[model samples]
Target: MGQGGSREFEGGPEGFPPGSERRSARQAEEAPQENAVVPTVLQWSQGGQSVYVTGSFNAWGERIPLRRSGNDCVVCLNLLPGTYQYKFIVDNEWRFAADQPTVRDEMGNINNCITVEDQTSFMREEQPSGFFDNNQNLYTQALPDEITLAKEPPQAPSHLWCLPLNFPPLCEPHVASWTLLPPLGVTLTHLLAAAADRSTNTLSVTQRVRSKFVTMVFIKPARGSAADARLGPAPAGGQAAGGGFALPQLPSTAAAVAAQQQL
Candidate 1:
C-alpha cells in the first residue's frame, strides 16, 4: 500500500505519467521542425570561377559563397522579412545584379538591393531585437558546414588637401599674385587662370588663359597709369614689391607665356 502511494505521489500535479513522458519527448523533438525556416533562393545567372554575396544583413562583413546550379550560381538563405543591400564578388571582382534594384552605398559603390517579405508574421516574434546582435553566431548558424565565410574586404584609401587662406584689405588698392606648385604629375591650367583672372574682371582674359599647365598668376590695379608709383620701385628682377602690392615675374615657360598672351 505504501509503494502504491509513493508511485501516485511521483506522478502528481508537477509530474507526467509513464506514457506521457514519451509523448512529451516526441513533442520536444517536433517543436523545432514546426518552426523551421523556409528557404529563399538567390541566384546569379552570370558565369564565373567563384561567386559570393555580402551585405548589410551580415554587418557587410561575412561573404557567403554560392554554389553552381545548372547555368547559374545560387545561394539559399533563411532571411527574415526586411530590406537588404548586397553585392556580388565574382572571381574577386565586385559586381551588382543586372536586373535587381541597386543603390549607391556610402562609399559610392553601387549594390544590389532586395526585399524579403514573410507570408505570415508567425516567425517575426521568434527573431531577436536585432538580427546582427551576435553576428558571428548568426552567421555560423545560417551557413552550412560546407560554406565558408570570407574575410572583410579592405577599404580604399582616401586623399584630402587643405589650403591656407590669406585675405587682403577689402577697401585698399592692392595687387595680388599667386604661385601654385602642384603635386608631382598634376597640372592646373584652368585653376591657375581662374585664380589669376578672378580679380581682373576681364572675360576675354579668362577665355584666353586656358593653358592646362599654368603655374603662376599676377593681378595688378586696373585703374591709374601710376600703378608702379603706388607699388614702389621694381626689384632687381623687374618685379614690383612692398607697400602691400606685389607684381609677380612673368611666366618663363612657353606654355605659360602663351597662356598669359591671352590675358
Candidate 2:
C-alpha cells in the first residue's frame, strides 16, 4: 500500500488520546470546593452504656451519640472552618477527654477544644472574587471563632399614634359625590382615596369582622412606625400650607383632611 490511504488510530479523534480528555475533566471535578468542610473524628476509649458528644459544634444543644468500636466510642463530623469547644458525655455524666487539650470556661468548667480548618484554605485565600464594590450582602466578613445568637428579640420603640375613624364629607360640590363616586358600601379603595394625607402624619386602616359579619373599619396611625422617619427631625410649621387644607396637623391626618372638607 504505497502513499494512497491512511489507517485509523485507536485513540479518539485525530492525534488526541481517548482517556486524556476524560482524565483532565475528572481532575477538574475532583478539585477542592470553596470553603469546603473538614472531616473530624472524635473518640472516647472508656467503655460505657452510651457515649455522647456535645459541644460548640451545635452550641451544645444537640447531643450526638458515638458508635462503639471495640471498647472505644467514636464519632465523625464534617465541620466548616472554625474553632469549636466540646465535651464528652459518658453515661449521662459530663466529661472531657483526658488525653486531648482542655480549657476552663468562665463558669470554671473544663472543655475540650478543636479547630477545623478549611481543606481548600478558603479563609486564607483572597475572599470570593465576584463580590464587587462594598456590597454588604456579598462582601464577606471576618467571623470570630465563636458564634452566638441573642436569647430574645430587641424591644420595640415607645411611641403614640392613631388614625381618625370618622371622615368629613367629600370636598365635591355635591355631598352625594362621595356616595355615588364610590360604589354601594364603603370599600378600602375609596376609604384611602378620600382619606387626607399630611406630610407630617401617616394613616392606615384595617377592616375587622364582627359577630354578624359586620365589617368594622379600624384606623391607625403609621407615622411613628417608621424607624428612620420617626427619628428624623420634624418639619417646621403649624398648618395652612398644603393644598388639601390648612387644618392643623393632628395625630390622624385623615381626620384633619375631613375637617378641612367641612369648611
Best by TM-score: 2
Candidate lDDT values, in order: 0.52, 0.54
The TM-score values for the models, in the order shown, are 0.32, 0.33
Count steric clashes of candidate 2: 0
lDDT of 1 by residue, 83-150 (tens): 66777777666778887789865556677888776556664556446644645656544547553545
Candidate 2 stretches with Cα past 4 Å from truth are: 1-34, 122-263
Identify the runs in model 1 with alpha carbons over 4 angstroms from their true place: 1-38, 121-263
| Residue-level lDDT for 202 in candidate 1 | 21
- State each candidate's clash count: 0, 0
What lDDT score goes with residue 204 in model 2?
A: 33
lDDT by residue for model 2 over 1-263, one digit each (tens)? 01123232232222233454454345434545456778899999866676778766664546677888888889999876666777876765677898988887645667788877666754465644552545677535877575454367756333211122344446776567433222223333223322464433433333322211112233333244455365564445522355222333223445545655798
